[model samples]
Target: MFKKAFMSLALLLISALSWGQGNPVHFTVAQKQVSPSEVDVVFTGTINNGWHVYSTALPDGGPISASLNVEKAVGAKAEGPLRHSGKEINIDDPIFGMRVRYFEHHVQFVQRFKITGKTYSINGYLEYGTCNDEMCMPPQSVDFNYKGNGPKDAPAATDETAAATADDASPADSAAATPAGEAQDSVAAAAQAQPADTATASIGDQLWTPVIDKMKAYQPDTEGKSLWYIFLMGLLGGIIALFTPCVWPIIPMTVSFFLHRSGEKGKGVRDAIIYGISIIIIYMTLALVITALFGPQTLNEMSTNAPFNIFFFLLLVVFALSFFGMFELALPSSWGNKVDSKASATTGLLSIFLMAFTLSLVSFSCTAPVVGLLLVQAATSNNWVAPAIGMFGFALALALPFTLFAMFPSWMKKAPKSGSWMNTVKVVLGFVELAFSLKFFSVADLAYGWGLLDRETFLALWIAIFTLMGLYLLGILHFRSDGDNPKAQPVACIMLGLCSLAFAVYMVPGLWGAPCKAVSAFAPPMYTQDFNLNKTEEVKAKYTSYEEGMAAAKAQHKPVMLDFTGFGCVNCRKMEAAVWTDPEVQKRLNDDYVLISLYVDDKTPLAKPIEVKDSKGNTRKLRTVGDKWSWLEQTKFGYLAQPYYVTLDNNGMPLSGSFVYKEDIPGFLEFLDNGLKEYKKR
Candidate 1:
């Protein structure tokens, strides 16, 4: 019986380990107001036996470090910086084969602030990572809020209630601080007496704000998503360009040249087949080399780096100008010319490959920018094979036409000739490139807290770009040709007019303060708008004080939805416009939810301690609302970009199977509804 019992216990241990594998990390936020002036924010992480949470401070080359952000009321001033207190654990990581120190069981981070107003609310989230002895789970975040009232509103003395709440210790008594309570109260009183003027200042008013805004503004909007979509977009772009004037004329000429060189339809067909394969191999190789060099982590880091974003913005602008006929981007003719000469001199497979390479190099002026754009997009994506897959799709699109036309040479007469219309197509794409360039600039602005471009400003710029593009399409504004005459073909005219009108309509609502939800991702926060229809009295009343709402959420045991979104996140806007509009999805989110929309790109700074540890493990004091959320996203979710949604139970535990993306709106809602059902059942 003893042996049997021991065997059963061992079996149970193995079962528990298997069950824990699917469990997510536990994240909780506990806030204490040390004084009227200062607040202490603590993040308590409980990892399963095998899992460990990294410290706010991590050594170089480790996974993302923990981070925090606080949103304070106007006139409040945060005192000192955020500090971490806990027993740090040292362990040897098998993955890196190095010893690393982190935290487990429980850890607390504290920040002190001075209040400047009679009343104010502080809000933000904690960003962190969870990894076990094995693999690391995706980074995640949990929202937190704390509110304080001024001395004038101190509660009347009540012996019974005082005793009941006596368990609450002053922030100063906490192990993290020696005299935290008195220091915090003094700061709060000072803030209340002389409200800080920094609240009203634009982001440019501060030096550090610009740095944070720059990082936020320039992050790539599309880095982590389905690979199929990236490849499909490239393929579609290629197909559309095939109809452009630059390459259309070559279709027939190239086929005729091959027919003459081969001397027969059968031989011409075979040569065309070989050329198509050669094109695929060449483009795929280029994509492979890029992926092999950069890797996913480096590519993801590039998505948020300010300098990279600025460079990309400038690069796209150059491409746009080139497309508008400012100048052509051509490869040195000597290289392609030499390859062409060799192809003529040689026969067989080597000749075929050389001829294919020559055609690609020779067409650099027309296809290079498009290819470059596609490659850049693919590189930023999460999938390792995305770049290669996208290039393969693009090459296929470019090659299929050549191969098909070769097989059916008699149908060549029906093909359209290259003409002025090709210039129009190039110019239209230029407008698109110019518009996309702004997105990068917006990321830089938000990351560094620069107030150069707000939601309205970004929308206004897009409106102008699309409006001008429409006019150009309708022959209103010509680059190479004259006046707005209706000389263009009927189909092209209608297509241009409709596209222009649609985009213009989209921008019009934005000016009026509509969520313009469709493009919310790319726009700045709605709060950044000088006027907003969505910010009505009803919305204001939903959460009058952070404390009350937090208490209620805790009592009810409902998962909180902390939405780190931005108006400038094109993906966020797309989600609002396309996904959230679905009736079923909308109802679930609006009715059974505690939705806290925290705009990471907002230029508004908090008056109190929005202190967070950056990915590097240094304490970062947040000045703007964006800084808080951005830090939270990076530290917790291991994500630096926006339109991120996180759900946590009242106790701050993430609901089982609760993480979701905007694209999976239906799934997201289902996940929430299922959680609600489970709660109700309990």
Candidate 2:
């Protein structure tokens, strides 16, 4: 009974340590430029994927921002505040209820201090904190040392001796607050007692191997649409617009004018085609001008921007209301009359071109909204030519009908009679506009991390909206324009109603925490699920932290499988949700080894920074939780990418092999079995 209880306790402890996010960060300081007059001190932080550290500014009660505190050196005077590159990310935390600014991936700081020709050594330290989706770590300080006449390729500017420690180290003074000499001594002494294999070791002249270079996986970008996709979307919008009441009637009138303008059939056909071409050129030129003025990135920024999204929400609402017969949005008749007079007064090609321009300006009320919608779509596409491509498609479809009917007037008889169906189409488009407007709200919800539009909430709202839309399609519901006695629904409306109903039914399981892969891209992540039925006896025998995991693995006389992974890593999650969830793989992982999962991108900082010299004698400061783990991986195995899996015996010696992103279950099983066999032999 005692042994069983101990085993259960051990399993629980081991399982808690394997949790991870991918971010790990390291800092290196250097001299950007050296001269007799002065030198530029540069500090660079190389942060791993999925994590971010605070910038040099933050509100009260928020995380600490990066700060550079330099100590006095003869013949040198520090100049200016530390200047960092990159636009600071200002985010409003839903949890903390405050705004914060941070830097991600990589950050650079430049500090220029005036100096004389006389030699001098400068010392300083940088203070910063890191955070990821999970949590935040306390701020840490990493010290640096620089020589006036240092070698061209001086190993590193960082001291590599002022590392974070278990105990507090008193700051030097108000101006230069690097830890005191006594504190550094104590830290070094304590570090000497640890095993050499550990990453946190203090003073050592240890032999080290070169880092093994490995190609990282090509992370797929989930944002933006393809250019061709944008063009097709614009084409779809144009086709829909062609059927609207505002533009359908103009087709016959425009074609009739071209036919009456000239008696020669060839001249009439040529003029009609030229008129259509003129419309295309006009719209395409407008699109180009918009792109040049606003720039492509501005559109991309507006896509997820909160204020812009809100503005869009309101604008779309107004458009939908207009379609619902709230009021007509029209251009002044005087403007149209003047353009018509210009067309009548002009002659030759100019007359035909003026007429085409007149139709565009006349149809602005109905076509403007559609054009604006297409341009907005183009902006979100992240393509330079998307706007132009969109306009080309829109203009092509808009102009084609007039040209075709003018060329062959007989086809005009086949055109569907413009009547009540046009209003139905408008009403249907209004419903679509209302439904999609919610997407901007969803983007705001995710960006601000607000719980207002959680997965279930968003899904529920969509289900209700689509259900109502389906009802309307079935003629069970009526809009403002519907007659007192509704006509039977058309086959087209019936088919759409069935699709909407089916989609709503499919989303029902998502309310109960289903994966909902079909709509996953639009919905919030699954972790937001407050209630889930799938939670049961599962793989819980993993570790969350390295020291605790190591202690347990050694006591249990089992090998350790170091799973280098990240929370923001999709492939890592895929492995967990798919491969690791396999019964055989779970059993093997649970029974065979102590799994110590470390996230290379975790932003949680250590209690203090750990400074160490690598094999090349370059001073590296490991500041965050991920930094410590990454240091171990690089030093021990000589590699720097996740999901790097290594099998280590109880004594922390490599047993069999290291694996990287082999997603197949059988392959992973073979790796585990081989490592276990090697461990048993040892």
Candidate 3:
């Protein structure tokens, strides 16, 4: 029903300096006149040293692929699919657990086109991502507008040119392409960028300190909060499902059957109690079924897996369609009939159990989508016990009414009459389900670097869905189940419909590039939007490395706020949108300190792997970019969690006590003020 933000103790941090390094790859778009009517559009990428740009042909789950998005092509049509040529090599990336192809130094992609007119302008954006040894810059865009003027000058039209073309036809051997010197140069550059006092040797000589804080002791605080949040989501979904026509109407009928069948007062109470218990057992069993087969570890992994995300997207879409009354998605009728037949033939307690099973089977069309949404969200929590807990919470809410109403026969008359409004609930949920499904789709799109569902596009779809749903609520639009020409809209319905309309209006500004902070976690980042009113930050000052940031802070006589964060961290994004964007908070952060953000999931490989032993006596091998930063966080601060924030002075002493997940603007301001006050005393 809702997504939970997850942060792992294993943190790998990123550098803020990478953002301003002038695009790891410089691009040029040129037109090669093949003939009077045919031309080749060649896109050339000159990659900076030590950086690798991914190929467009790479599969999903890898880094962002390089590609051209054609926005406008007047009087010109593309002849064939895009093709690439480069000094390509295959690297087995630990992050994706796959061998993917990438290019180094230089690459070119060509797309032939037929130009029908003399003055054709090809305008569009280029989407690509770049990563070096130290860190990867998130995918960035380049806008290109190319107009053909004259024929490209021939490249000396001779044998040497022919030889050059022949060489580029085949990929260079891997061993010859990457030299030891090239990797060392990048490392030395990082060293040079750091302040003079620090020894780069700590990373090399295994002198880096290891964190001895007990990981288990620290987990309950974060884990408990996360699990409680997920449980509440499940409870909320169950309560909402109760208002639907299919589930609501059957509640009284099922309770009445149990009360009538048992003959004595005590027996009726026992039968109803047993039936309610049976319902919980049935739903809990379903939630555990996946855990039983694959084990909890697999469920944890699937939460972040790319294919699983895409699968959830499609599955939710089907569920949304079913809820919209496109088709029923109940269990097989024969199966329900068999359970009912068994209940009829069986006596006493067994019959009561069978009746509960029958209820579940019959009501599945209405309950399954809601159940599926809750279970899917629980699975995404990546906690072993979350599914059982979520299902238990949902089933408890669902089963309570059945027992309570059976116990008190007179209360049945007080139940609200099932009306046309019940149908209204189902239709509204369909729109919501459809909107939530796009969020999963967006996660997959961003992970695979597919440009299909950008933030604006996501906002546009949501706007349309909410608008139509509002009209349906107002009786201006009708579904098959909604009665034609509804005479009087209830006050509740009118308010809900107006709220939906207001929500649609709220999203209109987002199309012109509003932050839409209320939904930032679900929407893509501001960088993904093509047009925007809010300006990008003018002062680019955050750093990813601890040493470099600290050194710079020391030189400038300021404090350093270490932001423990990640690419996949949901809460980090929330804090960035909700609190960090506040004027006072932003001003304080920008003016008071050198902000350094550490991303725990960055997978860029280290120049060379380091072997070190921590205080816990565990030998940790630091290999990837994430490993180095994660290792640093634990070693320096004796902590391994993020949105963990703390202020540090030049010589690496803590300026104030640590903070975690604090989003209140004034509270954060106080924390900053305290850190500054402590710094002055020092």
Model 2, span 60-103: residue lDDT tens: 33344576655444445565566788657886764334676778
List the candidate 3 regions with Cα displacement exceeding 4 Å.
1-220, 485-487, 542-558, 563-588, 596-612, 615-631, 637-682
Q: In what order do the candidates fall by TM-score, top score first? A: 3, 2, 1
Best by TM-score: 3
- lDDT string for model 3 (469-508, tens) is 8887787787666655665668887789889989999998
Q: Could you estimate the TM-score for every candidate?
A: 0.57, 0.61, 0.64
Clashes of each: 65, 19, 6
Give candidate 1 regions above 4 Å deviation: 1-225, 481-489, 537-590, 594-656, 660-682
Per-model C-alpha lDDT, please? 0.58, 0.64, 0.65
- In angstroms, how far off is 199's CA in candidate 1? 42
Q: Where does model 2 exceed 4 Å of error? A: 1-122, 125-225, 483-486, 529-682
Model 3 lDDT-worst window of ten: 6-15
Model 2 RMSD to the real structure? 14.2
**What TM-score quantifies how close candidate 2 is to the native fold?**
0.61
* Number of the predicted model whose lDDT against the real structure is largest: 3
